[model samples]
Target: MDFERTNPIERDAYKNFDDSSELQSDIRFDQVETRLLRQQQDDEYLQCLREDQEREQRKTQKLLDIEKLLANLCLDEEEHQKKKEEFVKMKEPMLLAIEEELSKLCLEKHERDRQKEQLDKMRKEKAPRIPVEPPAGLPELAHLAIRLPNGERIMRRFRHTDKLKDVFDFIFCYPNAPDWFDISVPLPRRDLHCEGSTVSLLEAGLVGKHALIPKRLRLTTDTTALTLRTTPSEEGLDNRRDAC
Candidate 1:
């Protein structure tokens, strides 16, 4: 009965409380807006740091790539040097065989010169024509075997080329020809590794020179075409020191 009688005063107090609460809520919204703005600015800084970290990783990866490339280049250089050394080693035996042959030829020429001198002096004296006799094989020359210098035979044999007459007259004819004749031969048509192979050229040129019997089945270059050349087989050439 009291609430009903004082209901208008109670309604007025309630309306005043509701208005104050709404005002307080508006103030709280303002404070939250300020805090959110600051947090967004902090997040921007974190994002920048993440980007920098990613960029550093990219730089590190690039440096590693460059290092790998450098390593590969070094490896290639080492391989090239190794190949050069191998080529020099392969050439040594062939050179020695050539030099030995040259020494033998020189001694023969010296003996020939001495013989000519004796003959000329005898002719100047007007002596009666004596029956010409073959000189006994100079014991020294007899010792010199064509198959091998040290009297050891090898598996392969080499002969001079017919077209090599000009080569002999031109290149090997030099004073060193008897000493350092490195005869280049032609490769066979069917031989593998003919390109830059000395043995191929030697086999072809020799077969063409009547040094070796030419057989359809034998390893031979096309003498007519005269293609590639390669180094001679090491052990074989070492045995045939006279082939040069």
Candidate 2:
């Protein structure tokens, strides 16, 4: 028929060839898609493995830090216990020494109390002796200069007939006299007792130029009361004493 017009067989062959080419192309496209999918899966698997490795490393580092903290806490607790033990050891001897000192003080106090009781008993048993009155012929007034232990002189004018208690009262009542003192004279060196002596100053030999040493006596008792008595020796009274 016509060269440009297709024959049925030729047309049919051409159609078959086109169909085969399309089929081959479709097969190749499918194979390329499958390969791309497999490669994507492999990349996903590699990323997951990298992430797991990082997580494992972080966990191991945290565990190491926790172990270090625990070790430090253990060391601090041990040091605190050691210091407490040392303090206890040092305190023991100090406590023992304080107890011993208190015991010694108690014993000494007991001894002092015993001695005080004996002196009190003796003072209570003995009756104070009555003192002699001033002699009948003595002058009415006597000018006396009494020197003290501190090198100070007390100038006084007194009645010869005045009681020895009056002279002592004047001395104790003096502004310069201490709260507690004992009166004595040198040469005879007699301690004047200040209790209940009714003797005159002239009879007690406290008149004229006499150095009446007022000795500062330590208080043996709690009482602030003063006790004085003149010596009973007539020769001691008769001696004229010089300035101290």
Candidate 3:
């Protein structure tokens, strides 16, 4: 009924207004849908950021643990080196002392061996000759006290007819006697220099008429050689001679 009374222009205007209102409603609905879609995309991006942050935290913690383990290993290595150094220092002096003791023992053993060899040689040379009766008619056995280089006094009885060389032979035949030597009379203070083969004890003045009193004879080793003899005063002290 209202459409019949209205003019064509007015109806046309009302229809256009209704169409405009429907179009506005449609635009508003589309705007709301777009806004909701944008909100969902933003939420997903925030979740992704949170996941990345958590992964980064875990990686950082693992790196820190590795660093701590490395630091502990370095400390242990340093301690081991210090202990090795200490062991070396403690062992050096002990090794040196042991070496020194071994050397001393070897030297002592060598000295003992040398002394034993010398003693053995002396025993094999027919040592300690016994006294025996002499041939008759030679001035009833003259007794004499012979002093050796080692301060040992040897007592022997000899015949006046025996050569002076006999006394020298008996004394020099003893063990540990020198290669060359000289004999001197102590009481008369005279050196005996008689020829060994020709001179007799009576000619050399070594024996007396008495039998009980023993004459003292000094035996000295020739220091350098038999050819070289210094003054009689310096013979016993300065030269490499041994005197009794």
TM-score leader:
2
Candidate 3, which ten residues in sequence have the lowest lDDT sum? Answer: 230-239
- Model 2 lDDT, residue 157, Cα: 68
lDDT of 3: 0.53
- 1-244: candidate 3 lDDT, tens digit per residue: 4987899998999999999998996576445434443454466568668879998998799678656644544347688677556656756885897799899989867765664454345334423432343754566566666655444556677776766656655665555443245565544445654234247677666675211111222333543333222111112222222222
> What is the TM-score of candidate 2?
0.36
Candidate 2 global CA lDDT score: 0.54
- Per-residue lDDT, model 3, residue 72, is 47
The TM-scores, one per candidate, come to 0.21, 0.36, 0.32
Tell me, by lDDT, which candidate is best. 2
* Candidate 2 per-residue C-alpha lDDT over 119-222 given as tens digits, one digit per residue, 9 for 90 to 100: 34433333232223344446665555445434455867666677666655555545445424567665345777666446787787766544455654443432
The runs of at least 3 residues in candidate 1 whose Cα sits more than 4 Å from the true structure, single-residue gaps closed, are: 1-19, 31-35, 73-244
Error of 3 at 152 (Å): 1.0
Q: Give the C-alpha miss distance for residue 50 in model 1, angstroms.
A: 4.5
Evaluate all candidate structures by whole-model CA lDDT and list the values in order. 0.37, 0.54, 0.53
